[model samples]
Target: MDIHGTIKIDELKKPYFVWFEENWIHDDVLHHHQKGQLVYVESGFQYITIEEKIYLLPQNHAVWIPPNAVHKTNSHSEKIKLMIMFADISTQESFYYEVNVFSVPPVLKEMIKYAEKWSKQMTVNHNENLFLKALFNELPQFVEHSLTLHISLPKDKRLAKVIQHLHNHYRNEIKMEDLSDTAHLSFRTLERIFKKETGLTLSKYQQMLRIIKSLEYLSSGNLTISETAYEVGYKSVQAYTRSFQSVMQFRPTDFIKTIQ
Candidate 1:
């Protein structure tokens, strides 16, 4: 898919701040912008693909997408409430070029909410400018709370096909040998290439997909623990819990409690 584009910010004035609340269902084309972007998920989960790696942003968390970074997004839930903001590139010196996910502090969260309300009611003014300045100033401190759970993709076309297949069939029982056949490579070669390109074995990559997907299922609050386990292809709840804890550093129950 030729899903690539750029977002121009020449129309936006300096010290610019914009907020949007969206419920995205379809996947967006990969694109980049000259201005930095901040995305905060207030309710549901979002899957962001950046540099061939997919990062899952669950509720109550935010991601900073620096200027000129190619990225795409897929919403995993209905009514996925997101607060998207754009800032001028010259406003901050410590802005990162890489995507980073961090916990949203209550103070910053309220600031964003207030900005959203204010933006809807009026245009940017002196008071709003001060809010934007303070928001940008406090953003750098939250970078230390970055969380990483990235599933890397390979550049090789054959391996890329295999990875896509696994992503589509993650909830099903998939064998490495079968994947090798799909990629038209020997099982050993498939294993080697997968590790070399993605720094993860095929099994581990599959596990990461499952765990990340489970976050969406659990966040919905409609599935029981056992149901979620089975939904993610885990035959047993214990196995699912182990994988969840290993990837998320917390049990599924505890995670649900926090998000709730």
Candidate 2:
């Protein structure tokens, strides 16, 4: 797929910067990225959906998306933000997805502005890298608003095990018995608890996840419909097509072509 590529401004020796001043959500955006991304709202508000979790970011906060993850963006038409995308993660690898409500410290603020300037100027001096490194070191996360996953997301042991297993293997038929094993409960008990916790049936959640992955693939435009179906673990194209159509109101090929 011809990606309506993010307006990237990366220097070979410096950071990649993006500054969206206004309703970037209305502008064309394709898939997410292959490198870590830091999205900080300098002004106005924006809503982001990542890994089935949602975050509403206002000024003074930022959200991070690890490489290759499925993410969606929502912006108020007046929203203005500057995003810094990089191949490098300044914090520990484990902290990559843990970013939320990061208080933009004085140092981090200017560094971001310098990067934005460079994004427009198309150049950065050697000393810029040192300042950039220092800024990322202590970008404080806001304590007041509670850096939360919007939907009271639980760390249910049952859900955790089921997720890992499906992630490792979503190609097989989604069997209630198998899911029950992951949850260490009888199928009936597991279903009841899963529904209560996530507000979605086990089957529905699994389907949603598959569809999200499928859309990411569709963004590439390179995968044939059959290839994408199997890639996301659908055993057959017809079954995958049905699911995609039911959820997204479009077949894979048609979606790709429409986006292209």
Candidate 3:
């Protein structure tokens, strides 16, 4: 069924939790629900596209999706385990109005594990009810740790074509003049509009794409760090490591160790 149809018919009238451990290879169609959604990735990584923005949710991180905000998810992994919790709109009305991705606190992670088990038993007690309420209350604290992983796409068709070209050839040295020609706009106009619409310079956006693609390559465990670096257009491993650490706040080796 289409996502919109499923959500419209299966509206959550009360707080609930649903856990999924599956191999997601295809993308979900854009959809929205009336209840707020807090999705946590326990393993693997997922790309969530909301409106014109796409956010990467890595392992041990989570994203809060405001109620009725259109979004979709995609992943290139075989072990994507996720926990999705739903709260009535009335209860979380003031929680968030847009997607907010952040690191999951250890305490909150444990609570989510318990909530997953509790949800299956369909048992509700005073203590469990209170626990759920507390979990909901603790969500706002994560807003501060939100990551800048989101990349907003341009809406203009001409600009979008240029962006698409960058996505296709991110591993090569793309010249600004070439991009301007592709978009059929002057260099100055293209630069200004690209920054204004996406809130990132064209160069920065290309780097962001390369970094995100590197994550997928690294997760596959088939390539060495140097190979991954070269595949993502880094001429040297040192340069790639620096860029990765600058954006992710950790070395690639550290991430590999954690996942291993």
Candidate 4:
């Protein structure tokens, strides 16, 4: 089953890796890995497709893809990632729905390799784990990026409010009427704004919402395809898979496989 999906994590080492691009390895076809990944592209750019969204991560940037996400790594320049794999399974849920990036500081750039060595020894103790945990917490949240991506919706003020609410709550499935009442706009006006601002109808946006949520979930090994699909309001995995493929242009399983 390729359960481990790892190299150098055999008997002698704990689940951790400091892979220079040349040291990277892959697994058998059709297997998905559930492990925390911290990728740092020190020189060039790389596009990591997770759940079908292509994130062009450039130099000085790092991405954290939680376990089990269907993702792949390809470099426009040399890419080096210091990845940590945790089989304990608890770290999977710590950040389950979204991918985050942080700017690497000078110390972290050095610490990434140092920590991996310390972890392998099995002797540095919990204090080392604690330090990593705190550093993870201090990692940057791209507030500017978030604000830039979020633009104000169309002019129907009430309608705008409701649509904004729904968009932000993409993880949860919302009904049309609830949205209408919340915005104090007629369903017709809200529908128009949904189309105008997002380039998709309200119903379409809702579907996109579920897809995105599922995308994040599918990438984070914390949720299985079936579990996350249903949780995001799909009635059947087959239906979710079809729609997922239509939008993402990549098979979920295949996407996960190539990432190693």
- TM per prediction: 0.86, 0.48, 0.84, 0.41
Best by lDDT: 1
Candidate 2: 10-residue stretch with minimal lDDT: 1-10
The TM-score-based order of candidates, best leading, equals 1, 3, 2, 4
TM-score, candidate number 3? 0.84
User: Tens digits of per-residue lDDT for model 1 on 49-117?
Assistant: 877788888888888988777888855676888877776666546555667887687778888888886
How does each model score on lDDT? Answer: 0.77, 0.58, 0.75, 0.53
**lDDT tens per residue, model 4, 1-260:** 33235443333233333344433343323323554566665544455655434454444556776666666543343333334423323543445335655445566666665556553344335656566665554444321121011122355455656666765776565677678778677888767765776566776666666665564455445667789778887888897888777655655574344232
Ten-residue region with minimum lDDT total, candidate 4: 142-151
In model 1, how large is the Cα lDDT of residue 241?
A: 92
Candidate 1: where is the Cα deviation over 4 Å?
Answer: 1-8, 22-27, 90-95, 120-124
Candidate 4 lDDT? 0.53
What's model 4's lDDT at 15?
38
Clash count for each candidate, listed in order shown: 0, 2, 0, 5
> Could you give me the TM-score of model 1 versus the true structure?
0.86
User: Residue 189 deviation, candidate 1, in Å?
Assistant: 1.7
**Models ranked on lDDT:** 1, 3, 2, 4
Query: How far in Å is the alpha carbon of 67 misplaced in model 2?
Result: 2.7
